[model samples]
Target: MNKYIVKMLSVNDNNAFFQLINTNRERLEDFFAGTVLRTKTIADTINYCEEIEQKINKKSYFPYLILEKESNVIVGFIDVKNIDWNIPKAELGAFIDSKHEGKGIITTTMASLIDDIVNEHHFKKLLCRISSRNTRSIRVALNSGFELEGTIRCDYKTTKGEIVDLNYYGKIF
Candidate 1:
């Protein structure tokens, strides 16, 4: 098994977070859309980190950095955002650096986090909205116990301005 750890994103993680996103920019653009495209400069990253810190304090979003245990390297990110307190649910998003892809690290990490989010965080449901073209992410969601709810046609506009369908998967606790 791969050794992995997941922790809440912190302001002090700015450098490691910037490096992770910078190195994975090209690959991340394939699915991340507007989010990753905005962080081209270190200043942009610092601003983004500050935004995340604010969200954390407000309890509006929870972003976590996925790290390799042995090397303590930032290999990926998994976040639960768009939190709705009334519904007590959130949307899930994740990406692994291309260099770290195909290692089952995200699967392990998410599986563990799901439990914490549901029990500790008291979220009643969690959902993942994935690009239909992203089969790997769909599989990861399924493997992590999210059931396919449905697909929304032309739901996402890529950074390149192309419209794409999205697969919605969810788990209800």
Candidate 2:
């Protein structure tokens, strides 16, 4: 496997991260629907990054930027959101640049972070809510050991405003 690194999203990563998102905007929108970002300019990306950074500081969300270790280029991201301290569970969302999609980067990165997410963050359950039509993402979640839980009907709206069902997958630590 190629070496990769996962770091908490930071102010310093704005440019690289923005470029990655902008380049993959269309592909990302296909799967992410409601969550896919549509950043038209650098300022928009900076604002988005700053919001995520604040959430990280407040412990309400954790968003990590994935990079190629050799070049330190932004390749993807995995985020843990909807953190519930009482239930000790969080939702996991991830995506990789289309160019890097088939290399197993996301699966490996998620596996690598499981330990830290469970031990350091104290999350008992990690959930992945994937669009039912997104086979690639479902495969990634399964490869990382997340089990199919159930389907959420009309869970989200697509970029084009179509309602879709979501496949829920979870990993219990």
TM-score top scorer:
1
**Candidate 2 wrong stretches, greater than 4 Å:** 30-38
Candidate lDDT scores, in order, read 0.88, 0.86
- Which candidate ranks first by lDDT, i.e. highest? 1
State how far residue 156 of model 1 sits from its true place (Å): 0.6
Clashes of each: 0, 0
Candidate 2, residues 1-173, lDDT tens digits: the string is: 55899999887787888788778888877565433463567887778778778888899989888999999998999888889999899998999988898999999999888888899988889999998998999999999999999999999887788899999999998
Instruction: Indicate the TM-score of model 2.
Output: 0.93
**TM-score, each model?**
0.95, 0.93
| lDDT of each residue in 23-77, candidate 1, tens digit only | 8887778676555865778788788889889989999989999998999999999
Give the C-alpha lDDT of model 1. Answer: 0.88
